[model samples]
Every structure is written in structure tokens, then in C-alpha cells.
Target: MTQTLTVRRSAFTVALTLPVLATALLALPPGTAAAAAPASGSAIEWGPCAGMSGLDPRQQCGTVPVPLDHADPSGPRIDLAVSRIASGKPAARRGTLLIIPGGPGNAGLHEPSRRGRQLPQSVRDAYDVVSFDPRGTGRSAPVSCGLAHEDLAMERLRPWPAADGSIDANTATARRLADACQAGDTAVLRTMSTRNEARDIDRLRQALGERKLSAWGVSYGTYAGAVYAQMFPHRTDRWVLDSNDDPDPARVARGWLANYAVGVEDSFPDFADFAADPGNPDRLAARPGDVRPLFLALAARLDREPIPWPGANPAQLNGNVLRQTLLDSLYTKQRFPALARLIAAARDGGPLPAPNTPPDEAMQNTVAASLATICNDVDAWSGEGQAVYEKDVADSRARHPLTAGMPVNVMPCAFWDLGPSEPATRITPHGPSNVLMIQNERDVATPLAGARELRDALGDRARMVVVDSVGHAAYVDNGNACGDAKVTRFLLTGERPARDVYCAA
Candidate 1:
């Protein structure tokens, strides 16, 4: 990944350690639907949660009924799964702040209970924290491709080119998967664009009767929050976008997909350093000199002669399969062992161990959801033919050898037939002036370059903090004191950094 020293960009209130379950939440009956909130300002109707079980009486869970297509609110609709732990401290209660997670596939409904528990008291005290599962994810109106059991494999789901760069199988897989999505609900699948998601957010805001929303959006959710802030600026207050992405209007998710190659390049060094550590029992190399070469050699060898990995999702370990495994494992330092173990075994000419595989029922759900959201969002493969990507895969394989042709290669999106419902919405300076950005200096998925682009796109409307660190995300990923303090302070108080500051790693 290229390190961009960027200046093109221009780019939260709260204070307190919020209580476990806000007293404000306890005031409302549990399990009330998000839609049930009356239009009355400052006073929301409440009821017991319908699906919540085993929770303390304070926790509330319910569904938010939203138009499948905002253009046709009276038509088909779906529910967004939601949960809330009202502000624990009634004294500092400001308003609700929604936590939007990444993955376009990540489930946030449980976050008010999981990640929310970690908020500083000031932040927790002031905000009635709420989170939800976006449409087609988690407990919402879920959609599955009904993919074959074998296709659920991650290596297969993401297109990894053949050893010699032939993309025949990739084309087939792309076509097969895209066909499944097209055959599903032609109406709602088309409704999965971020614009619709933004409209759904405003609807939620209107239902809650809040003049403004305090939001924490991370990764893919940053784009969602940015869109919400842009489309309904008056309704937003104290917006923080962490681990941002490139908000390129022309490509949208296409650009995001392509960014994966550079994302790996930016993040792999940390993994390299971890594997080079002297104390690592599963260390692949004694000296730092041996790490890259050893990884490259193992991948190339797997390309020339594959290994059998029975019990893994795909059941057989092929070249691209090993490459894909390497890519996913690079996301965290703790997972370095999975890569090292594979390399050490390959180097010693020993039998590669059988990978553990659990029941793939949930795996099916994950795969389907990933596709449904990505495909539903944008038209990735179009006039951009495979020729450009073929060269890219071959060139990237030569340059980064460890990841082989996996990241830059063709994916199911290459064959997707659906076009974006509307041109990708360009996030502009048109939104409210109250937005803060928190970024890790080195992020894998949402790289600094893209974040700079997003910052520039937002113009003078936002401020940013670059945490001196290397990882996929900053918040919850790095424990930097300054980074956390800056984030916590912003979330609790309406204050922001005097100027954009860079905290040392």
C-alpha cells in the first residue's frame, strides 16, 4: 500500500461513563418497537421488548419497521433489528447515539450490549446508546443466495486467481453467485443501496422524535453515517466516523473492493514484525530477513503443488485457498500463528494439518449476507473488463507474492448483472458542521489515503485525528491512550481537537 502524505482533505459531544443500562432506558417499557416511538418531541412511547430473553429488566430489544424502498413507503417494508441500554446516568443524559459497525456485513444490534459496555462513564452517562442490524443482516429481513455448501468457502467466495493467472473458474463463480442474487427479491435487493440505508436512518430519527442524532460509525458504517449526515444534516449532532473509507462517487464499493490489495500491503508489515519476534514459538523465521521470503516461497509452492486440507470449509487446500487464508489471517496479530504454522509445515515438507471446520450453517448465512449487501450496494464489474484486472493480478502476484493474486483478482462482482440503483452518492460538504474523524495511521481495510479522500470530500465540515498506529481500525483495535482519550472526550463532551492532531503510536 502506498503511504499517502495527503493535504487534499478538509475534514461528537458527550461526557461521562454511561451506566450499564441507562436509567432513561429503564423508564421505557422493554421490547418496544423502534417504530412505536410517538412523534412527540422529547417523549417516546415505550413497551416491553418482544424478542429479548434472559436480559436484565433494563435491557430492551425490538425491531424498527422501515420502508424497503423509501420512494414507496407504502409498499413492502422490512424491520431493522435494534437494541438499547438507556443512559445509565439520568443526570447527564443527552440523547441517543447509534453504533454502526463495519462489514457492510457486521451486526451492530448486540453492540449496545457488547462494545457499549466499554464506553467511558461520561459517554455512557450522557447518551442512550442504541445499535441495530441493517437490512438483510443479522436479525433483519435476511436474504441468502442458498449457495451450494462448497461455495460458502471464503477462498472461493473471494476470487483468487489460478497459479498461472487463468480466471475461468473465477468467472464461473462470479456468474453463479450474481445469478443467485438477481433471482432473489428483485425489488428489495435493489433497495439495499446506502441511500436507502440513509433514508431508513432519517426515518428512525423522525420516529424517535430527536431533533438530532449522536452517532459512532466505524468502517463501512462510516460511509453510512456520512451519508446520513449529508442527507439530513439538520438531524445530526456529534457525529464521529472512525476507520473511514474512500467516498468516491464514481465507484463506491468498487473502489472499496479494489482497496483491499493496498490494505493488505499496508497491514502486512505489522504481521511480519510479529512473526519475526524472538519469543514466538510458531515463528517462521529466526531473523527478520527470513519472513517475507519464507512466506513467498510457501505461497508459490502451494501454487505449484497444492496441499489437501480436509475439514476446512472448502475441504481441499488449493493455491488460491492458501493465499486467501493468508489474507484473512493478516487482519490481526494474534492470528499470525495460523499463517506461521502453515508456512513452517510447508517449509519442512511435512504433511499440512487438517484445518478445523465447524458446522457451516452459520457460515452460509455470513457468505450470503456479505454478497447480498455488496452486490445490492453497487455495480462493481462493468465496462472495466477483466483485462485490466488480469494484468493487475499477475503484476500484484509478482510484487507482493505473499498474497499472490487474491486481493487484486476478479470476484463475484466481476460478473454481477445488477447496476447500482442510483449513482453512488458523493459525500460532500453539504452536511452539518458537526462531524469528527478518528483514524489509525495505518489501516488495512479503510486505508489512510481513502480517509484523506473522504476528509477532503467533506471539506471544511469535519475534523480528523490520526492515531499513530498500524492496524485495520483505530477504535477498539489499538489501545493508544491519546487515541482513546481523544475519542472518549469527544463522545462525552461536544468538544473536538483544537486542530487535527497526530498521536504517536
Candidate 2:
């Protein structure tokens, strides 16, 4: 779930790399006044959302105040920006359906307007769709590490190993990024963790006056939703976790990053099929079997003799850049063409496509928040040093050449200044049986293996609908009609499969 700074049509655009250490929440900085608390039970004074042109006209924006540290409710506070598109049919409305976004860093306040519009009519009529910017993202008391533009590039941010498989530069970069975060806004950044996000969701629930909440969480949102259901089991109604993560509390984000090795192996075949199809405008090979070797050879060649691409990030089409592109492209089949075209250009000496780097300021904000949440979520990764990471990278590269050692390489977390405030929350099968999970069989970000781990963790409290599809999200995005129908039915009628089911592609 590495954030792509490039603009794309999908909601799954947040990056996921790096880490931060957790420690006791920093004391309020000297002379900085704590934010005033909001009056209890005050309703959001909804109004036109600024800077969100092209948003659904019905979508209204507001903010809710929550403690900067949930552990100290009366201490300092920050506002969480929230948005809602009320039920299309108020009389038919059942309750609020929260849309938890992915990335841990992704701002979800606009999801109600974007993804909400894609909901089936029955769902739109049945609930007031709501979303929010998690504590340190978007307009919700946003934070930045003021990262240098060069460091913010995806190639650097994702920790791709040196062309020769050495992690020396990656290790150095990790330390530098960690130091930047330590020096910049440590107070607010330390508060960014999955546990606090769940707490913030509850605070948002209270502000919206919902006694209970039904939700649809995608990608990283799935993990956050699972945590919320665990923390406030009674407050959950119908819950849907799409594109789930492995809730191995001990590994947490570290496990998630390492999972990319398996995820890419599982997803690459789909891309191969797309690239080898004769009907595809950007076909890479005549036979599906040839695509893998061709890509490997081309990447290897690029590693040795990189192409100079003037406008692209890093200003070159090198092997790691190509590998990063493939990883990003595997998120969905719709992105397959882009990957194919890049390969064609690289192999044929054609012009490279323009790079889609996001604004430097936005990249800084997202990278900072992503690092904070993952690092602070668990301390499992804290003690690993250069040797440990080198071994991991070497092993990963040997087994999964497509992702190389990027997934297992060191991140900012290894050098973080703080430590986790509390132990990571272990998701267990003790919650209400309102949970339903829909997962793509070959999601490159949150693969089926991790989803199955979450399913096993949830036990009978959850039922899974595995779609024989490819891509990151399952429901209504990359899933087939069969999968979509099943998920929509559950959200609209609270009916789940009697046992785990599979929908054909």
C-alpha cells in the first residue's frame, strides 16, 4: 500500500512505507496553548466545503474536536474534518455508514462524495454516508515533515535496494527521513497511530449523533475498521472490511511491508495476461509465458544502462523505477496498459511517459503521516539494524525478484526517535458477527493471504467472499458483478453467506 504521489482516478492512492517509533505521547510543547474543547454533544454546523470543487452537491463538510491524545481527553485537542452525503431517502435511512479510507494517511473526507456516488441506489437510500480525514491528514490538523523534494520521490520513499542489491543507500535514506520526522512536529506526529484513529472514529461517531455505525473500510481502512470493531464492539452495526490486512499485532506494519513480496508474485500473472493479450493496444508479448522473462530482462538491462527521462522523477527510467511502476500498476487491471506501455517504451527506445509526481507539499504531508502511523502502530520493527535488514533484503530479492528487497528493506521506523505508546491491538474473533469481508484474489497491496489471516482472526464473527478477480479493492471497484452483488446485499440487508463463498471472475 505504498502511496503513489502520481494522480490517478482510484481512491487507493495513498503511499505506505517507512516507520516511526512509539513512545509516551510528547508533552505539549512549551508555551503552546492546548486547543479549546468543544461543548459536549454539539452538532456539526455543516457548510459548503472549501477547495473541493466538483464534489457532489449534496456533500456537506464539518469538523469534530478530539483530544490530541485520547489517553488525556482534557489535555490538548485537534479538529478532524468530516464530510457527509445524507441518505438519499431519509424515510428509508437505517443509520450512518462510515467510509474509512486506506493509507492510514489517506484523507477520506471526500470519499462520501467520490466513492459514495458509486454505491448502489438501495445503499445510498439506506444510510447517510460519512467520511473523515484521519487526525493528521487533509484539513484535519494536517502535519508535514517538510521533506526535501528529492527525498519525497517514490523511488526513494519505497526503499528500493541499490541496483547491485546493496541496502547501504536505503539504510542511509531511512535514517535521514527518520531524523527529519523527529525534528519536525514530533508532538502531532507522535499522536498518529491506528489506535488513535479508531478512537477518533468514535469521537466522530459521537459528533454525528449515531448510536451505532455501519461501515465500509477498504485497504488500510480495513485494518482501522477491524481495530474499531474490536475496541467498540457494541457500537458496530453491519461492518464490511474490503481488501484487508494481516492483523498480526506483533508484526503490524512491518508484516504489511514484507507482504509485498508475496502480493506481487500473486498479482503479476494477471498483468502478464493483460500484457500478452493480442487485443490489448499495449501488448508486451504474444505469449503470456514470455511476459515475465521479458520484463525481468528489461529491468535488468535498465539497471545496467538507465534511460534519461527529463521530466520524470529521478530524471531517469532505471530498473528500480521500472519495478516501482510495475508494483503500482498491479493495483488494478485498468492500470495494466500503463505498465505495458512503459515496458514497450523502455524496450523499444521510445519516449517515456511524463512522470506524475504530486505537489511537493502534499507528498510531504502524506509521507510524514504514513511513517507516523506505521511506525507508532507497533514496535516490532524497532530493534532491527542494518545487518538484519540486509539479510531480509537479500532473501526477498532471491525469492521475489519483481519486488526485489524493497518490501523487506529498512524504513524510517528502524531509526525512529520515539517508541509505541501502547501495544498494538490484536484483532480477535470476539466481536459481533456483523462483519463481512470481500477480497480480490490477487490484490497486489492487500493480498489474499493477509485477508485470509484477518478472516481466521475474525473466525465465525466474519464471513468472507473471495472474488476470483485481480486488483486491490474488491467491492464495486475491481470486483466482478457477482462479488459486488454479494457485498451490496450484505450492506443493504445484513445478509451474509452461511459460510465463506467464492465469486467467479
1-505, model 2: which lDDT tens digit per residue?
A: 2221211111222233212222122222212212112223338989989989889999999999999977679999999999999876867887888999999789998899899988998999888899999988999888888888889889999999988888878877887888888886677898898988988998898888777788999999999999988877766778899999999999998999989999999999999988888888888899999999999999999999999988777889899999999999999888888788889999999988777768888888899899999988877766655677778889889999998899998888877756577777877766567788999999898989999999999887788999998888888896489889988888777777888999987
Error of 1 at 53 (Å): 8.5
- Minimum summed lDDT over a 10-residue window in model 1 is located at 4-13
What are the lDDT scores of the predictions, listed in order?
0.69, 0.84
| TM-score of each predicted structure versus truth | 0.86, 0.91
Model 1 has an lDDT value of 0.69
lDDT for 208 (candidate 2): 82
| Model 2 TM-score (2 dp) | 0.91
Q: How high is the lDDT of residue 116 in model 1?
A: 78
In model 2, what are the clashing residue pairs, if there are any? 2-15, 2-16, 3-14, 3-15, 3-16, 20-375, 21-418, 22-419, 22-420, 23-419
Candidate 2: regions farther than 4 A off: 1-42
Task: Give per-model CA RMSD.
Answer: 9.5, 9.3
* Weakest ten-residue segment in model 2 by summed lDDT: 1-10
